[model samples]
Target: MAKEQHKTNAMRTLDATGARYEARFFDCPEALSGVEVARRLGIDEDRVFKTLVTEGRSGAHYVFMIPVACELDLKKAAAAAGEKAVAMVRSRDLLPLTGYVHGGCSPIGMKRLFPTAIDETCDLHERIAFSGGRIGCQIEMAPDDLARVIPLSRADLIVL
Candidate 1:
């Protein structure tokens, strides 16, 4: 007998779009930082991204993806989203707003498709990895393929 794999909403969404992706799973019982995840997966931190949700001054929600080793510059992010300012949504509000718990949020399959931006640095990579809509899983795919699944703009979003 073999164990059946559990498909997350993110994985299902990718399947529906016919996007090419690789689902990688590791032993993670609780939430961990992106860098930690990369370390556990024996992957380069630069190729791993972390999803962040923020609320703009206009009350609009936005998503940003940046390399695990970098930090999101709020000012740059706001500029990318065309907002006066943006602040990270509280962890308690993540589930209700994005249908994903902290540390498990993926840019795809959110409760709603919010404005999304990926750091321009992502373009430098042939492929990138992000949360697979769960704490213990990851999804790796080409940047262009991800853009085909979700409408996103590339911007300089990381701190200098």
Candidate 2:
């Protein structure tokens, strides 16, 4: 018998929006680095994106998605969000702010829809993968499909 698929808020949000996506699950009881996740799933690290939450100087939160292997450039992120500066939100504050734990954060279905940006590199891929609002699951879909569900701006968010 096949394992039952776990439904997540992110998945449900996509479903409500009529977005097409594929869910990939793995045995990850503990948090793993993004590169490790890509390796375990046999996906190119560049095709696996990480969702990052940051607070602008004005105290507004913002979301950014970038390739797992790359580092988010704070200056660029701030620029994209139209803030004087931005800093990553505290790990402990993540759950209360976004309704997600540190490693399982997803761009979709957050506690609130904050201003969001996707790394320009995403345009190079036909599909990208991100957390499915849980530790062991990932959602894969075309970038355009994701944008249709969540408003997203394209920016150069990663370190070169």
lDDT of 2 by residue, 81-124 (tens): 99999999999999999999988999999999999999999999
Model 2: residue 30 alpha-carbon error in angstroms: 1.0
Candidate 1, clashing residue pairs?
none
Give per-residue CA lDDT, model 1, range 1-160, as digits (tens): 1123668889999988999999899998899989999999998999999999999999999999999999999999999999999999999999999999999999999999999999999989999999989899899999999999999899999999
Instruction: List the pairs of residues colliding in candidate 2.
Output: none
Q: Over all chains combined, what TM-score does candidate 2 have?
A: 0.97
lDDT of 2 at 148: 95
Instruction: Estimate every model's Cα lDDT from 0 to 1.
Output: 0.94, 0.93
Consecutive 10-residue window with the lowest summed lDDT within model 2: 1-10
What TM-score would each prediction reach against the true structure? 0.97, 0.97
